[model samples]
Every structure is written in structure tokens, then in C-alpha cells.
Target chain A: MSPGSGPHTAERRGRPRDSGTDSAIIETVLRLMEEGATIGALSIERIARETGVGKATVYRRWSGKDALLVDVMKSLEETAPPLKGESVRNDLVSCLEFARRRGLAKRSSAVLRNVLGQIHSNPGLWGQYQETVIATRREAMHEVLRRGVHTGEIRPGVDLDLLSDLFTGPLLARAVLRPDGSLEEGLQEGLSEQIVDTVLAGVAPPPVAGG
Target chain B: MSPGSGPHTAERRGRPRDSGTDSAIIETVLRLMEEGATIGALSIERIARETGVGKATVYRRWSGKDALLVDVMKSLEETAPPLKGESVRNDLVSCLEFARRRGLAKRSSAVLRNVLGQIHSNPGLWGQYQETVIATRREAMHEVLRRGVHTGEIRPGVDLDLLSDLFTGPLLARAVLRPDGSLEEGLQEGLSEQIVDTVLAGVAPPPVAGG
Candidate 1:
């Protein structure tokens, strides 16, 4: 259904809208997604039924399943706190910690895994995910690295793009491959510290000879 | 079907076995897997039909789909060359280079991606993958790291498990998330070197004081 022609949208213009139903639909979508349901598998009818709302209610907010999924992913991105700290190391640790907490959460990793599985098959959803989620996170990390270089805390020639991957990739790989329920709390904390320390040490500028 | 009861096994004991048929089945399985077919989707009936063999032929070789997949993954593991070099850095670079070349190969990444998607869902299949694929690779990398520590190339207290992830995770992540086709050749080479250099610099023991 086109966004402009949906019956619920027309009703909204004539009368007050039910915000609760809107949230209910979104929550249902998130829960299903976290349970490993793909976008193609989640029909609007199923979502509306699961949410105990009419089909028109969902169609009013989202034109289709892809639109709903994009909205849900955006909500996740919005919930993530921005990265900021006194030093580059602190900033990186905090940013990584943010990712760790999210990864450790029940359903979050499953939701991400489901998305990663189908990302190649669905370019439109992938593009939205990149823009709303990945691009924003990368931009925050880039700012920290840029500031570190400006302050001479990091070597001038370090490739920030590669460095970013090095810093985040292990943690992400662990989350996806091993999942959180299997790991001890101490191990998780240790891994975070280890990754941060390694990156910091790697990027530190060499001391001037004979100083 | 039990392993000992298979017609192929019986034939092996009585007369010359059809090595060509065995290879043909494996090749068809790999091709289907690389095209994003799931274990559940690849029934013995389908595989036999695709290979122009009877259901009894496939059943005689593999007890079930999981067994077949495990065998396929083992075949992939056997194909990976062992890491060897004059120094720890060289060993690591070579190891990662092997992974890069494999990732860049047509259809290989797709097969890996397809497996990764279902790893969390199927514990039996996952255990086989871990034993046959992940453990072997990690052990080789561990040997190189252990030698590095003994030679004082890497610091003594470095966490080898976490270090292994740090070394290989970015490459794997890039293969799955970005896929090598989209990246330029120079970028791939540069990334491999950057990862190696950053890791080597990060893990080197502190310079001797006042040296």
C-alpha cells in the first residue's frame, strides 16, 4: 500500500491517532526480528495480528515491511549513546563498551545476526542500515581518532579506517561467533580492556630519538 | 545409515570404489552451499537428484544432512595451507594472506557466509564446524604466537586467544560484511599490511630502557 493512500493515514487527518497502537506494532516487529525473523518473512498481516492492531494501523505508519524494519533499526541506533571522553583511549573504550553492552543484551545479537544474514540479498535495507547505524558509529569513532592525531596522541600516518576495523572487529566477531551467554563476565571485560590497550599501544607515536 | 553399512564402504572392501562419484557429490554439495543453500534445504533426495545418483548412493556415504555438511566443512579445512614463516610477523601475515585469498575467491565467501548464518541455530553442525575448521586454524595461529613469545618478539604476557581474534577478525569481518569484490586490490593489500603492522607494533615488548 502506498503511504499516502492508506486508510489509517486518512483517518489520522480527520481524527486523533492512537500512538499506543503505533508503538505496539513497532515492539512486535522488534520482538519478531530479534527472534530471527527476516523482513521477507514478516508480513504486514502477521505484524498487525501479533500487535492486536488492524492491518490499516500498521500500513498507516509504514508503507511496507522494509519501511517498518528500517524504522526499527533506526530506533536501535537512536538508543545508542554518543561516544565522548577526555582522551582518545577513553573515547574508544566507551564506544566499544557501548557495542559490548548492546551485544550482550538478549535478542539484540540475534536481531543483528538475522540482519547480517540477509544484508546481501536486500540492498535497500542494507543501505538504510549502513546510513542509520554503521555510518553514525563510524563517524563518532573517526572524530576520536582525528582528535587524537591533532593532539599527537596517535601517530600522524595511522590509517583511521583500518584502525577502526582493528579496534571493533574482534569484539564484533566474538559477539557473532560465540554469543554472550557462553562467555564469562570477567572474560568480556578483559577482552574489552585488551582490545583498547592494544589499539592505544599500536597507535601511539614513537618517542623522539635521544630526547 | 551407519557408517560401516554404506554401500561405498562395502564396495571399498570388496572392490575398487567410485572415487569419481564421491568427488562429484562433494563438488555438487559445495556448489549448492556456495549458492546460499542451507543444510536443511539440501536434502539427500535433492543432492542425489542434482548429482544424478540414487538416494541410496548419498545415504550410503552420509548418514544425514548434518554429516554431509560436516564432511564438506572438513574438506574446506583440509584445503587450507598451514602457516609457516621465518619470523612471527611473517607467519601472521602469511596466515592472514591465506585467509584473504580464500575470501576473495569466487563463491567461497558465500559458502562461509551461509554457514555462519546458521551456526547459532544448529549446535551439532556448529560443533563440527568448530572442531574441523575453527580449532585447526586457531591452533596454527597459536603456534606462531607461542613461538613469538618464546623468541621475545611478542610480549610474554600477551593474551594469545584475544590476540588471535584481533589478528584475523578484521579480515573475516571484511569478507562477510563488505565482500572483497567491492574493494580495490590495493585496498585489500594495504589492509592486510596495516593489520599486521598494527598488531606487531602493539604486541612488541617495551623498548629496553635507555637503550
Candidate 2:
């Protein structure tokens, strides 16, 4: 083996990768996740049972629980359809509504919340999942904020990072804390509207309300 | 018991209710919590071993794990001291700092996150804990926002509930999602300042420089 060869090349020289079985396992995991089974509750045995695969086959692919779970999360991450629009408001609304519909679905929400809690305890899974799910969302929102800046709709000096947090952080906080796993009423209607207003108006005493 | 008896009269029926036993149990739980123990992980025997109280005593007070956990959460809720002073800025600053500290504490944050996960699976515990901790914080923040409206610090038309969510939600979201279990540095220093500016200015397009 050449010292300069990368891991990808190294793997290519070995036994051929089986994309079919890999995708099948990941699909099953995500489907079970959509059905409200978390990694904590649904063990390797359960997955084997549900997928009708031997335990050795599962263990052979993913080294352990964390690896398997990260793969599952990675597979689900791609399902968020890409945004398509020029309007910043439209972009934000589309992304938030997607999160609201997919992440907040009754079964998926429970499993995802459980996954989030587990991620805290398992650092590797947390890092991979956060970079994929949490960071991806922030980046998408940042692009919208950047567009607003270009259009002169938002103030130029506003901190983009903080603005992103201020925009999406509320939805996450409300979603995770809610007992019924639902966003607040009017959330869909007014989130971007209020955010735009606040970013423009500043939070000091309002100027005479145009009276 | 008379048909017309009032709660105030009933409150005086017993010796000051001690309230000390509650404190003892809560403190014990907090100590265990800081050590990264969960209710599912906590055993009556272990708590008994630590507190030097008989298992019977613990059971006599709390019916089981959920009941004890509810009280433990109640104790943690007390850590968020109520806001004082009349200035909207002071109230917000104090409240946000309190949440930032308490929610970001290494041990407390873990336990609370665990409890939130368990709450979904256990409905009875969810109702009580939410009312005690979540509702208490909401009410406290509600009062502060109300003051902001009256004192002309915040715009009158802003939705009090959404505004409260807006201000505190980011703190909670960052705490649970971030790997570091701490408030983001920018938020710790400038969240309150930015919020104060945004609430007064609104996120609408600014009319002038630094407006």
C-alpha cells in the first residue's frame, strides 16, 4: 500500500462496498425513528428484529451504537428538501415550515428529542449530528439574513450570527420545551414578520409610534 | 369541614407545614444530580444510603420515582430567583443572567434535559413539573415584559408571550443544543443589550444611521 494513499483509496482496494445493504439499514433506522423508537429504547436486537437481519451483519457495518446512530441521522438529514427562492422571507418561511412539519411530527419529534438527549451524553454522535442538523439550519438562515442585507431590507451592521440565533432559536426552544411537541399558535404566521420588524426597529423605547 | 371554608383558613390548620423535609429531600436530590444521576438511575436504596433516611421514609413522602423527581425539579426551579426593581432593563438583565447561569450549569442542565426526555414518556410527572418550573419562569418574565410596556421601554403592541419567548428562548436553545453546555459567548455579553435595542426599534427597516 502506498503511504500517500488516502483512506478512501485504501477502502477501494479492499472488498467492494455494498451500497445496497448500507442504504437499507439506514432507511430502516430512519423509518423506525419516524415511528417514535429512539436509540435508547430500540437496541441492536430490536433493529435486527425489525429488519430481519442478523446481529453480526449490523455489527459488521457500524462499529457501535454511536456509529450506527450517526449514520441514521446523516441519512435523515438529506431528506430536508433544498430551498428555492430569491426572497429572504420566502426562504425563511420555507425552511421553518419544513422543520415544523418534519421535526415536529408527533412520532419523529419524540424520537428526535430522545436522540438530542442521548447526543449530550455521547459526544461523537452529538458533534456529528449538531454539525449536520443544527449547524445546517443556522447556515441556511444566515444566507437569508445576508440576502436581506444585500437588498437593504435589514440593517447592515447587525451581527449575522446573533441574528440567526434570534431568528431560529425561539422556534427550537419552544419546540423542545413544549409538552405536546407543537409550536405556539401564530408562530408560523408571525415569526419572520416580527423578526424582521425587530431587526429593523431596535429594542429601545419605540419612537413616538408615529403619533 | 364547613361548606364555606376558605383556603386561607385551611392553611392555618397545621403547624407551619415544616417545609424543612421538603428542603432536605430537594438538597439530597440536587447533590445526586450534580453527580450525574438520573431518576431512572436513582435507587431508593442509594438515596437512603446518602441521606441516612430510611427507604420507608422516602417512599412515605414520595409515592415513587416520578413523585420524587417532581420535587427535585421544584427545588431546582427555586434557583431562578424572582426579578426585582422597576426598570425594564434591570428586570430583563437580571432574569436573563439568572437563566443563563442556571440553565448552563453542568449538572443542573444535564438533569433537566434528562427530565424533559422522561416527561414525555411519563404524563403524570409532566403536568406537575411544567406548572412548577416552566410556568413559573413564564409568569416571571411575563411580569417583566408587562413592566416594559408600561414604562415605555418596550413597544406596547409587541406580543407579551412571544416577546418573552423571544428574549429567553435563545438562552435555553443554546444551552441544550450546544456541546459546551454554556450560553454562547456573544449572547452572554450582548443578548440583553441587543434585545433592548430590538424591542424598542423593532426589527423593521431602520430609518436612519444607528436608528
The numbered model that scores best in lDDT is 1
Every model's TM-score on chain B: 0.84, 0.72
Candidate 1: stretches off by over 4 Å: A1-19, A36-49, A53-65, A180-184, B1-26, B36-67, B180-184
What lDDT score belongs to each candidate, Candidate 1 first? 0.73, 0.66
lDDT of 1 by residue, A40-143 (tens): 44689998888776787787678877677777776665455755667778888888888777777655665565555555556677677777777778888889
- Which 10 successive residues of model 1 chain A have the least lDDT summed? A1-10
DockQ of each: 0.46, 0.33
Candidate 1 CAPRI grade:
acceptable
lDDT of candidate 2 at residue A174, scale 0 to 100: 66
| Residue A182, candidate 2: C-alpha displacement in angstroms | 3.5
